[model samples]
Target: MGRNTRKRRTPLAAKVVAGAAALAVGGGGLVWANFHASAHEEGPAHHRTRSAAAQVATIDCPDVGQQLSGVPDRARGEVDGELATMDSQITEAYQRLATTRRAQAGDPRFVQNTILGPLKDRRKAIIDRIQLEIDRAGGRADDNLDQLAGCQGRPAEQPQNGDGQNGDGQDGGGQDDGQNQDGGQNQDDNGNGAAGPVADDFIDINDVEPNSRDSENGLAANGDGGSTGTFTTDCGVNENNLFNSDNLIAAPGVDNGAHHVHDYVGNQDNDAFSSDEDLANADTSCRNQGDRSTYYWPVLRLQDGTEEFDANELGGGAEGNVGRILKPAQAELKFVGNQQGDVVAMPKFLRIITGDAKSFTNGDANANSSWSCTGFEDRQVTDKYPLCPEGSQVVRTSNFQSCWDGQNIDSANHRDHMAFVQEDGGCPNGFQAIPQLQVRLVYDIPTPTVENGQVRNPYAVDSFPEQLHKPITDHNDFINVMDEDLMNEVVDCINSGEDCQ
Candidate 1:
């Protein structure tokens, strides 16, 4: 799209967008424009500034391939061989990715991530050294950067037959049955590829590097510390069943027809059809004692097989959530309370905001909402698909208000009823103070791999069914389902500043 394609934004937003765009190019490369901070209430139509400053993502050749450091001559053949393999794999994977018809068949990105993506990583490991050697030789390797990164031709430019599956660059004669025969990577519902996945099937932890910043005596920095009392929950194993065609979250009187599927945890019976009355009575899957809060979000599909979704209809990359890559599956939560003698139980049925469910990008919208790696709360990024550290959990933390207007459980904007804690993290006077809920969804997903150390295509909220799910702009609903007695205990725990699990 041309630069003119973007409608202008407010002055402040535009400035922030431009700066982020430049930064993305110089540091973390992003597409044409990057998301900047915006009001959570602002909708997606008003998202992303179409600034040219956003650099087309750049490829980062992997460093330390076999050797600690070396020049171009020693590894030219090895690099070339690797690149050829990548080209072939990219072509093959692209074909299957584009053609796979069923959602159960898996999204094309599944093939890219598992199959061809590894080739990109492998190629990077060797080429990084060659590029470094060239740089060390005093002549810049800028000219060769794209080529060495295993680009079929140029950066962001892959060999394309154009008619390939899911916009994959391959065409006729390249299509596959979407059967990932290598092993049990992302398998179909029928369990065709039932074997354990190969290394290529997982995200390359190295590609999405984690922020190792430690704060205060080597403990990972936390957004909410002992500076405030907290109410943490022991959200146990992922108990939600496989999301089938029936787990619909439609609005009142609405049907799940246009909506796509979403994996649900928390209250098993919770759905879009759920009401405050229905939720209050629903039992929960929480491992904690007497706490029956509900939590759910869009399910991330492995994209290994075909699903009931049709590719020819409103699915796929351009239309529906069809070709969308998914988030790792998991959710964790806690409630951060004030130091006030005793924090009161949050009113029942209070719908809270944590990370902006509408803030799809990691940039501007990330001022208050975004995903972060464990132990690094201060260094959150707006990249919807931020790679978490290997052996660590992918944490999505949502912070709710400690002070409520006391009259409304919900507001016209769904935000007016509550307010942020004071700069000192204290509740304001007049507004009835309640337990500040902090939901942390930690998925046990491996670090997703990146070819050329760049995120080529990031998923968004619209990638899923519209009626129910929103992409990375994730915000969850919670209806206090605790028994009256359990609620009192929670309030007592918070008010007394006692740590309760």
Candidate 2:
């Protein structure tokens, strides 16, 4: 009966303990499930979705390179043909330059033409090459567009799991599909990446020369085919150096053997006697026919005969003799004869009167009237004749005699035939007493000799040898018109005053 009671207690205890253990296990499983579900909902899966959505936000229809693949290859072929033609033409130009040099040997003009002319042709060739490349690239541009359009037509795929199942389990995750599509697109983009089609229209190839030289590590040559020694290298470097310097020196010299001695005929000098004879002949031909006698005027002197009129005395006169002897009283007389035996009067005046003789006329109406003594009647005349004081007036001889006393004798009345005289104590109203006048004959009268029944003047007689008087036919006109005093007044006004008042 005691054992039955204990067994009942043990069964009850086992049931109670088993119930507690089941409850604990169930609660812990619930907690674990909740935590794992929350973690899955909040992590990388959410981030991946967001990232994928952002990537597809705005769809670019055609990528840069894909647009170029749609063009046909035939157009590219035409561009390639054009490039070939350009290359041929440039090659031919260079060959022609070489041929020209061979034909002309060392001619400088030919050498210059060969070098510079080919350079221009090569420049054109380079431009043509660049243009052809651009054309070929452009031909391929349409192909890119077709490829881009084809790519856009397909739908984007989603990411997949490693088991190759789609997220929806029916269409696979589409991620593997998308990656496959993207890989092909990337390859097409790379294949179509021909930059020449997209290059600027004015892309000049000359700029590439420096780039090419850099690629070769700067080992280069100058234009004239000489090594630059600086490491840079380019296509035209050696050619440029050769043409510019080295080739020029290698060119041959020109032949100049056609020169003749007759070219220097006039450069030779004749003997001295021959030159003198030619000069003498020229002088004889230019000689005048008249005045072979060489008449010289008498040399003037002071009354005391102390000083003779030398060339130095050409313009000197007594202080009171203002107009008595003309200013510039004497000049060397060289009579150039005309066709006849007489010297021309007007021409003689031109040769002797170095100063302005027209100023001596002073616009007097009488000066224009006549050459005789009658014209002198209206003009101012000097008393004591030509001898007058500075700024003095001359009166008629009748007036002079009227004012004269017999003792004083009115010495101012002195006159010669045509002009007034300054002699014998004749002094003008404003002047001091007159100085004396005298003459010293220069040319001796030729001794009469009977030659061929004719009397002739000796041509070789030595006379005074100092005569220097110049002829003055219009003496009254010169004296009455301008005087030294008036000239001084005009000169003074010009020097110290304004323009003529």
Top TM-score model: 1
The sequence of per-residue lDDT tens digits that candidate 2 reaches over residues 27-83 is: 101111111110112232120001121111011111111112222334433332332
Show model 2 residue runs off by greater than 4 Å: 1-74, 102-104, 108-119, 122-501
Across 1-501, the per-residue lDDT of candidate 1 in tens digits comes to 000111222223223322322211111111111111111122332111111111111111221221222234444333333332332233233223322323313443443444345545655664565465566655345444434333211111122222112312112222224442222222221111111011222242335445533221112112344325555776554443523212122222222221334444455455535566766666666776477666544444332222323222222211223322344455556665654334556666666544432231111222243466665555444334455565666565555556777776654234556676665445567676677666566555445444432222222332222111122345444556677776777777766556787
Worst 10 residues of 1 by lDDT: 189-198
TM per prediction: 0.48, 0.12
Question: How far out, in Å, is residue 177 in model 2?
Answer: 76
